[model samples]
Target: MPLIYQLLLGLVLTLLIPLWPSNTLPFLHLLRSLTTTPMMDGISLAQKAQLHEVADLMLEIYKTLAAMRYIDAQAINPGPHNVSDLLYGLDPAVIYLYSILPYIDKDFATNTAFFNGGIFADFRKSDDVEQGRDPFYGSPSEENFEDEDGPYMRPWVTPLSLLGNHGSAIVYDTRQHHIWIIDQEGWSSTDPALEGVEDGEPDSINRNYFAHIANRPAGDVLRDMVRWYRELKELPGGTEYSDLCWDHWDMDLKSLFEKNGWPDNFDGDAFLVDQAREFCALRAKGDAENPLGEVKKFTDWKNGKADRAKKAQEALDAAQNLNETWKARFELWNAERSVLRNTEELKKAQQEADRLCPNGVCQRPEDLPLWELVAVQRELGWKQNDLSYHRDWAEKSKESDPEEAKTYRAAFYLAEKEVATYEKAYEAAKADADRLCPGRSPKSVAGIKDLDQDDTMRDVQRRTELDVILTRELDALREWAAQIPPEANEAKGMADNQIEGLDKSVEDNQAALKKAQDWIAEEKEKE
Candidate 1:
């Protein structure tokens, strides 16, 4: 990765970190201290676990957002689509919605249906499809399931299908027709639906099934459904079909689902469905009372829905941020581990190199005398190539290593000295030659000039190589030097400050917790 990208990632990670299970060195120590005991008090354990889960969720959400931070928010729209479409609609905030969704397996064909290509798409996977299968028909597809109320009632099928997967509670605003997918999750856990169905009444079977379904496009399906439902009732609960458009589908559908033997889970789904019914009831009371009065009623519900939506969005955003921070921290930590492993490998290689070139492992003093004899033979020109080969081998043996820059710095200095001596000698020889045979021959004069130029160029090349070696050595030294421990006092000061801040924050939180507990106790006593 580029340094700029690493810096940017670091900045992002810093900005979005969780309170618990943090990778920040200071917090890691604090967390370790908190979990030192083998066993924790049950309540405390639960609380800590909850906190961890929340943090993890937050981190997951953060990761999701970071992954999708480039998406155009307005362009993202999910419908009665599949998981792919739902994913397409995912904003950073929508990622949180996914964390809480039921199905995640892409292989499960049942969950393939979804309202839009967002989190709901996950709910509409193959597995979910299998689970939420319409017992009434062997095939779960809309084409296969015959519409009992005829073509005019075809639109009712989607709302009814949505009722099954997401549960019955949903709301739509009167003005903009803003739709909120009510989370009736907790309701399912405790709902009467867990009770077994009576014999010969399959429709009454207790099903914990919640799934998003694939259907015709959301816009067309919804518009047609509302149109059909309004026709089904001469008056939409005493209101005209004109009033029961997209804006009224939220209410009318809720009532339709309830009237159609939708199980009353007694969870929030049931509550919200009832609420929707109430709002529609109020709307049906007509405009004679006060237009502003009706507007207030609508706004009140709108405000509540908006508040829920905002909380859901916040939870999603926090989860995404938290997930992203942890992922980066993990990636960096993994990279660090790789570096450590490479360092170990390099050490092994060095050990092997040292073994190959042991000072007294193979050669003795007698052998050294033979080497000297060989050198003398070379100097006498017994085999000039053989002599050159020995010299080259000896030089390379000294030079061969990535660490040569550090190890050969002193050697480079000696080489520099040798080059200086050669230059001085060559200069003197050139001067003597010029004085001894001035203008004796043109060829001779040109030969001296060439020697001077060649000598100068050779010196420049040697110096350049020497400088390169020195620079490499300097860089390696600096790199290794940076690994040294910081001053004790400097480290201690930072540690003290961190501990102090952590202590203060913990104390404040404890105090607030105690106050909350006391208030709860007092309120219970009063009750």
Candidate 2:
């Protein structure tokens, strides 16, 4: 893999990251003592293991997005790029001045589904090679000499070969600060080369980012990668559509497998799934715990008088700059940015946003258009449903996973807050319509296609939601009743009784749905 594949991934900066576990490394502590400056714009951190996770997730997302695009457009003229120059060069931020993959030609496929010729070749493998290492701490499988004990742990060292050929890069961001492993390009990461450092731990972590000086924990970076992976991986038909896992990289992975002297049959289809299943299986059997124990706390070994005062002073000073550079609402743009590969689309959007709402600022109702608010309202309904779903999950999962239940509860709370915010925006939107465009219902809003025939159709929405729930309940009851053994008389009777009740529920819901449909028709006819 080269820089082009990373560009295709949208975040070349995050494709390869150096990681430090949350409570382990002295990096964060050392920073607390020394530097008072925040990370530079678009500058963040990541670990090698985290990079591997990101690589797996992003390749899958690219596959899904590519498939979706194949159904519509026949225009993908991607080109190769050597981004390592800009990333590790004299003035790193100079990249934004020009487009990297300046290709003009386009291609089409004849039912091959995203096979626009050689364009998909580079996205076949992932590795961080010839980049973040020095003196090459020989391959992991290599034998140790008289001075060594075993195969050393290949941690992402700070000292690196800055001029190493065509590996990953630490690129710039238009907005936001969060570390990611970007431009992680190499083949045969199917057990590629590894390097270790004297000061680093002896584990098989492939890459790390900005480890030379930066000190944020790699844990959060890894967590976000997982979340991103889960979100995009679920977007496609998913494991039910199992071929998506390989992202058409099966051949490349197979080649690497063969070259590395591994098993003959290396199926990329289960590349990610196998890891998840195997990890869970191992974890279920027994955790691979650290024999010497893990680092649970940080020790400021040089806790001098000046160091303590400096730490206290920095903490006090940080209070003044709270909420200055970033806010939570504007967060996650980096994640979204990673997938935004269309420059023309992004440019048009940016231009349009600048025209309608300057600097991403809008005067709520006045600046809010009817269709935009309608869209917002429609999204809020989804969020409202999400709020309810998370609430249900939080309650239901408590018996199975209390920790996951807490996560659901937190998501539920967030959805509630999000819904509340949307509700306020909606009220403000309605008030705007009432004040500015008087006597106009949603139907009166010209050119808005997403709206129902009339506002009374909201009842149809509610009734449809009710119908779906009742139908699901009926299906569940019938399935349950069928599962009950005839010999288990008491249990069978209970199932039969519940199924009867659910049958009535479906009956009543169908009636309600019909009524709603009738009302909507009547309202539209009257109009």
How many backbone collisions does model 1 have?
36
Candidate 1 on 202-254: residue-level lDDT in tens?
23122322222111222333343334333432112212211232134444544
lDDT of 1 at 449: 20
Stretches of candidate 1 off by over 4 Å are 1-222, 225-494, 520-527
Error of 1 at 488 (Å): 4.3
Any idea what lDDT model 2 has? 0.38
Error of 2 at 17 (Å): 39
**In candidate 1, what residue range of length 10 has the lowest lDDT sum?**
150-159
> 362 in model 1: Cα distance from truth in Å?
73
Candidate 2: deviation at residue 509, Å?
24
lDDT of 2 by residue, 1-527 (tens): 23354344434223322354656444444333222323223323222223333333334434434333221122233323454443322222222111122221121221221111112212111122222322123333434422233332222222111112333322212122223232234311111011121123424333322222222233344344334333432122121122332333322333332333322333332332232222222321221121111111111212233354454445445544323212211122222322232333345545544543444432333323454446556656766999999899999999999988977876776567557756665665566657776665545532243444444576678678777766865675576457445555654555567678878888987887788788867877999
